[model samples]
Target: MNTVMHRKPKPYRSERTTAHTSDRNASAFPSKRHARRYWILLSLFLFGGLLCSLGLLLYNNPVPVQSPSFWPVVERRITAVTTMAIAALCQSLATVAFHSVTNNRIITPSLLGFDALYSTIQTSMIFFFGAGALIGFSGTKAFLTQVGLMLVMSLLLYGWLLSGKYADLQLLLLVGIILGTGLNSLASFMRRMLDPSEFDILQARLFGSVTNADPAYFPIVIPVVLIVSVLLFLSANRLNVIALGKDVATSFGINHRRSVLYILILISLLMSMSTALIGPLTFFGFLVATLSYQVASTYDHKYVLPMAFSIGFLVLTSAYFFMYHIFNAPSVVSVIIELFGGLIFLTVLLRKRSL
Candidate 1:
């Protein structure tokens, strides 16, 4: 026996092995660097959008004085800009959060009957209490009540669905669709019974509109949005995990049930805020969320959330700017937005891509 000390089988360095190592290294670092670059690009886009909106807001002002004092004009412009920014931020954040919780980009918080409940609540108030009562309805108090009701309803629905043996997301969505239709029918019935003047009042609230937003409501809305955003940011990592499907998440020691519940409550609060602030936007969330995904090309919540918000801000701000300045009709923005958003929905559906 030639006692040749068997050298550990010469490490077989195959071409495949070398290629895999190279691929792994590239994946490990290049994507991260790419994400950073994408973030920078997004930041630049937001800055450019803001400057454009500001320019449009100041274009051809009717103030008696030519080029009024810079500070006062700047102050007013800032106020308008702030309002648009806050509203866009709140809506986008809420929509993205809603999509994440459901694990389906096609489904929005509004689709889960929150907006329907809002409509029913508002319509019922007008029908029973009459239009005059709307004047007495404290905006903050009403908003809180609506949010609370939405939370309860969402919890009940999600919990009930989870408790059942045959529960599935598709079933839940179907139930929501039916419930929403039912609520809309109820609202329409009530509207038909109202007097002509009352019908006019109800009609105004039926469709989505942002023009009626009152500055007084911002005090409450801003703080609520900020708090929710902070909570979302902290849980951003968990959201990314949750997106990998419930089974995988549970294996990773995540409490899937509890996490879903928390997400539902957060979505309800957000839906209530947006509905109260600017009425029901049936397709706006779908439009913005889908568009953001296309633009960002990543599912990381850290990137997706901010990108969605920025896109939402840009779209809404631009729409308002054009309607008020170029079109000389601020009231038409909502209609145009709805029309465009609907077309986007159809286009997306036709493409058959997983939303």
Candidate 2:
């Protein structure tokens, strides 16, 4: 004991302190370089989207720039671009938020039967009321009606399912799937009974395209979207926490169920608006959100949402522009987009091997 050298023990340091290093990186990005890369990528996507939109409005415009008809033609194109912006905003924001809340990157808002409900409504219109009713079942009034119907049903779903002791997301998803499958079967049966001419016309109406949108709904849609989008942006931080799963979110003092319910309501509104605005783009949101995760290279919704919107806008405008002017195949543009989106979906599934 006497021979023991009295050595002052090394001052205690936490693992955090001991491990601190200049090499440490952000959670989402591996290094500072990756953080910088995110901004650079964001800028590029934004610029590309704007360029495509301008090209859509002006490129191959047969009317001379100086002529009187030119402005009118451009004005018409403006409507299409506006529709693209709304659709992009809705899909991107909704999908990203939906992913965060659900804690699942693979499934999309379509899982909740919004798309199925939309399809059923359209098919039922043609089946019961005739194709003429389906044709006339447009304009601003009809648009609002469809949106209202979607929101109402979504509210009922959220309210009824998310309130009990047995409140469970998996349960809700299962119920939605069952409901969707039944509605889909009904719609399919109705479609089969229709005359070929009616079926053809109905088929044309069902395909999502810019031409399907009417500019008159813009005034109503713009205000609602702006309001909801603001709400979402304000909830970005909360979304980040929620994305980490319920247990983690609860430990962090968040009301996981309530937050999820509120967020789901917002998502429903977004999906409804997009579906009403331009029919159902089933995989468009998935495509946008997936590419955004790759391009954003971060878990931050604030940045991811913007990136998704930019990419979506770029995809839609560029696809329509190139298809119409270069390939003269505007009719198949939506088909092409869905095909690519489906292929990408399969690739992701195979790579992950689990949803």
Superposed model 1: Cα runs more than 4 Å off = 1-37, 64-80, 163-171, 344-355
Q: Tell me the lDDT of model 1 at 221.
A: 79
lDDT for each residue of candidate 1 in 204-278, tens digit (9 for 90 to 100): 775666654656677887888788887887788888888788888989998877787677667767777777766
lDDT of 1 at 166: 75
Q: Local distance difference test, per candidate?
A: 0.74, 0.86
Q: Give me the displacement of residue 149 in model 2, in angstroms.
A: 0.8
User: Candidate 1: worst 10 consecutive residues by lDDT?
Assistant: 22-31
Number of the top-ranking candidate, with TM-score as the measure: 2
C-alpha TM-scores of all predictions: 0.82, 0.90
Count of backbone collisions within predicted model 1: 0
Q: Give the RMSD in angstroms, all C-alphas superposed, for model 2.
A: 4.3
User: What lDDT would candidate 1 get against the real structure?
Assistant: 0.74
Error of 1 at 188 (Å): 0.6
